[model samples]
Target: MLVLLPPSETKHPGGDRDPLDLAALTAPELTGVRTELVETLVKLAGDVPASRAALGVSEKQDDEIARNAALWTASTLPAIERYTGVLYDALDVRSLTRARRARADARLAVGSALFGLVAATDRIPAYRLSAGSALPGLPTLRAVWRPALSPVLAALPGLVVDLRSGSYAALAPVPGAVTVQVLSERPDGTRAVVSHFNKAHKGRLARLLATTTAEPDDVVGLRRLLRRAGLHVEHDGDTALTLVVPAV
Candidate 1:
């Protein structure tokens, strides 16, 4: 099974001397668009004010723009290690055994505005761009990405568990891919959507799926696996699963 994860805004910086090699990333079909976006970002970085406005960053975060300026020559880190936040922190990839890490490398892929989609082991630099960012002289990111990314995701094999947030998911829609929703179960038996800890829960779920021996080919099997792992999972529909957690 392939689990699609959202890229994090907060990333661990610095890597080995090797720079980003677009051809080495997964989904070679996206190389053209990736290269286009990267070049545009590098050019935009030359104008800090424009870069800050376009990327929705403040002067305090100017380092991010500098990272984009050096994108082509910057060192690289594996995608999984590069992304860090509540979600990735919960995934705790650094603690996984070598065998489980191998499994994660095979089953996990990240949804990126910059790269389209990159495998867990894909080496990438720390660059700043959001799914909503609109670079000068280019179409909306959604417009640029959907046409190119959707087809590639649609053609992937096995069950796809899409855990991307709304914006990234909009970049590419995977028809028939099982989607997940995190809900908080109140003492009154009513449930509401989780907000603050949603990513944390998804991260744990991703870790579970990555390490499990079961290969769930469909929603039914996927739910079974989560249930077996002690999560309160319920069927939302044929193609969606709801994970119920205690209200915080």
Candidate 2:
């Protein structure tokens, strides 16, 4: 099964690897849209003020514009390695065993605003782009992405566990894919969707699934695998799982 994750907004600044190359990314079918976005960002980076405005950055965060300017020339790192946040910190790919790391590389994919979807080991550089960013002359990112992105995701073999959040998931719809939602149980026996800690929980779930040996092809089998990993899971529908956590 393939597990789809959301990309983090924060990233490491530099890397030792080579520069960006669209043709070499995992989903070649997205190269067209990727190239368009890359060029748009690079050009927008020419004017620092324009870049800052376009990316929703303030004066202090202008360095992000410089990063965009160097998109093609900046050193690269694996997509998983480049991202840094609560989610990535929880996933913690750095500490995994070699075999489990390899398994993660094979099973994980990140839903990207810039790259559309990239595999775990896909090399990428530091850049700033979010699902909500409206680039000059471009329509909503979801509008530009959906048509090209959906077909590629649909064509992937085997079951898919979609873990992408809001706008990232809006970029492409993964029909029939099993989705997992994290819910918090309150003292009054009430349950509500998790918020702040949600990403961390999803990250943990992704890490657990990535390192596991079991391959689940359906929602029931997926729940079985998650249960085997010690998660407290409950079914939501024919295609959804709700993992319960005590309220914080």
Candidate 3:
């Protein structure tokens, strides 16, 4: 899960391509990092010629070898998602535990990467929902929230940040009737406990979830409900459920 990238366009997308403005390390430390990076690239060159070519080593056979190596590296990593740019590559670490912070950070340093989207997003919603009823079976509703929501929740605006320890959530405008909270399921399912005073949509959503047997239709209905609740929905996978977030 260690995703490394050159400090180039690979890491910055539409943003700037230079090195990130992280806390400046001493020159010797920076040089050591560069040396390690070069060594990594050299190792990659033995199998990944493109990695070597990036370091100014050019040979047709080397290029072919590099291409295959790059493909292998990209595919072998446990990352659920990865992207290679002109100068750096990015990865998303998935299906991991909280103890894997270093691995997650390595993936994140490449670009606009995220980690623990599901757990972080679900925490607030679950807390909010528990205020009305004790969440006894909450931990039991698995398969719905935790394992599947990592990628979906990452795209959300405020879910990745710890708002409970700060006043960030307070700054959110309460547009009267629409309030969405994240909810966890027992069997590792991901869900949202949306509390809108508009009872009709809520009732509709409940009915849809209860009756819809097909996963696609269930996600479609969920997306429609979220839109009605003033949230934006993005559909990526047919089997993957839609992620709901406050609209910008």
TM-score of each: 0.99, 0.97, 0.19
Please write out the lDDT profile of model 3 over residues 83-127, one tens digit for every residue: 232211211233334544333432222111111121211110000
Better of 2 and 3 by TM-score: 2
Tens-digit per-residue lDDT, 33-122, candidate 2: 999999999999998888777788889988888888899899999998889999889999999999999999899999999999999899
lDDT of each: 0.95, 0.92, 0.27
- Distance from true location, Cα of 158 in model 3, Å: 6.0
> Candidate 1's residue-wise lDDT over 109-182, tens digit each?
99999999999999999999999998999999999998989999999998999999999999989999999999
Model 3 C-alpha lDDT versus the unseen true structure: 0.27
Which candidate number has the best TM-score? 1
Error of 3 at 79 (Å): 17
Ranking by lDDT: 1, 2, 3
Ranking by TM-score: 1, 2, 3
